[model samples]
Target: MDVEYFDYDNYTADIDSNLTTEGTLNLYSASSSSTYALVAVNIIICVLGLAGNSLVIWICGWKMKTTVITIWYISLAISNFLFCALLPFEVVYMITSHWPFGEGLCKLASSALFLNMHSSVFLLVLISTDRCIMVLFPVWSHNHRKVGKAFGAVILMWVLSAFLTVPSLMYRKTTVHGSVIQCHTDYGVRHKAVVLTRFICGFLIPILMIVFCCSVLAIKLRSLTHKSTKPYKIMAALILSFFACWVPYHTFVLLEIDFKKHNLEVIKTGLKVGATLAAANSFLSPVLYVFIGNDFKKTLRRSLSSRIEDALAEDIRTALR
Candidate 1:
């Protein structure tokens, strides 16, 4: 829902043709409050997300021994970090309603946003699937799940995410409407196809897979009376957080494909709010790891980095056993 990803082709021409000073002032006046609020929220998310995810990357990437779980956490942190790094451009765009970064950065920024979407969800699916395998066939998982295989899967996830983001690179354009420049996607005839592809590949299929894996893990744990439920609880929290953050963003995006049926202002506002929720998600994982990784008392006493390590170490060992 960054301005770079909005489809403004339909209205750019209208703005060009009907540019009265009064109308411009009215438009600015009406939207300025919300725009400023969004800018503030974006800045906050960018700062916190960068800090939190950087800690996660450093702790998981360097401080801990390399393992399959570390690989997943590091990859996920990298994706979120990259997205947060690019969010300032979006903040500037939202404030000025202009894109001075030229066409290439426009495409890159837009593509990066979608790349985060695809990679994050795909990684979640992989994590869930890995958990399921560990739960149902601990011996097989312990024997076959290697750090090299996790690296291979991470590579494949990035490649697939990049492939899916090609449409953003192709369609994102910078256009001049009066003196202001805008960065937006111009999908032309393929808008529906592109949006549908994002919904299905980025959200629907991956979420379903996550749900199925979690369900299986839940049922398996339920049957084993002696097994601790902490791992299942942790995985459940992750899946639920993911679903909560992404559902609104994807719902508004899907609605946008046929935005005519809904109120236009409502759609735009929904998109903005949904986008804010999505942005907040980049920071939520590290916080979740800090607080939910251990009990409240232990988390309070432990160093932040050690908390993350301990959180993963305990549950990961339990799952593999």
Candidate 2:
């Protein structure tokens, strides 16, 4: 969802306005209104995601009592906030099709994006693991799910994310394309390996692990004959929504690596749509948490922080009982 999309070779576009004497394509187009529309959508997403996630951080980090679950949610919200913060840079670059931020900023932005994504997904995995353990081994979970442990795990997740994001940081660069300066990654000789590695590590492994943990939790609940299947249902929905958002992005990434020449229009459109969907996932998390954790209609009256505090209190009471 980050500059990974820009890991392709020298890109050429059909929009004709920014052509130089040497005939290179600019990032934006004066003629292509669709690009502007996509940029508009990104801007909206940026504002909403930033505002919503800030509230989440305030509530989860400051208002709520520390718990394993709250720790995980805090980590998730932080990732969402950081990711949304970088969208404005992307918006400007997309609008003018120019990289005015210089090489250092470009690398930093790209690295931050990848870091957020990797951290976000891994945190989900940790949440799922914690939920599974809580359900299956309640006593052990109660004894062992300490806030310090969760904090340590979150720190490890960030370390892993930062380490994995090295490729983007190393490869992202600014180059002059025709008359316009463009920022993108040059995957060069390691393109296929990098693409496959990212797909497997960034998407496949986490999802598979999530699905496994959720499935095990579901079966355990079923065997116990629990009447309220709402938690399981919400977990399923969360995983499904994740797959829906990311599958297209990863699929298009793989296709773009190989079929970049075959379907120019489709590839370009898919890239735009995929990035939007992926970025939109940030704001969607807080919504999903609110809906799944509380009575959606009832929570509407109170502010988001109040609603989150109420829902988290409910969760703690449930866990204790």
CA lDDT scores, all candidates in order? 0.76, 0.72
Error of 2 at 218 (Å): 0.8
The per-candidate count of clashes, in order, stands at 0, 0
Query: Judged by lDDT against the true structure, how good is candidate 2?
Result: 0.72
The superposed Cα distance between candidate 1 and the true structure at residue 311, in angstroms, equals 1.5
Clash pairs for candidate 2: none
Best by lDDT: 1
In model 1, where do residues sit more than 4 Å from their true spots? 1-30, 293-298
Q: What is candidate 1's lDDT per residue for 1-321, written digit by digit as tens? A: 222232223322234332332112112222557877777788998999999999989988778888888888889899999999988887777777778999998888767778988898899999999988988888898799999999999999999999999988987778777897767766656767777888888899999899899889879978987988766655667667878887888888777666567776776667777878887888888888889745798678878878877877776677655
Q: TM-score for each prediction?
A: 0.89, 0.88
- The Cα error of candidate 1 at residue 105, in Å, is 1.1
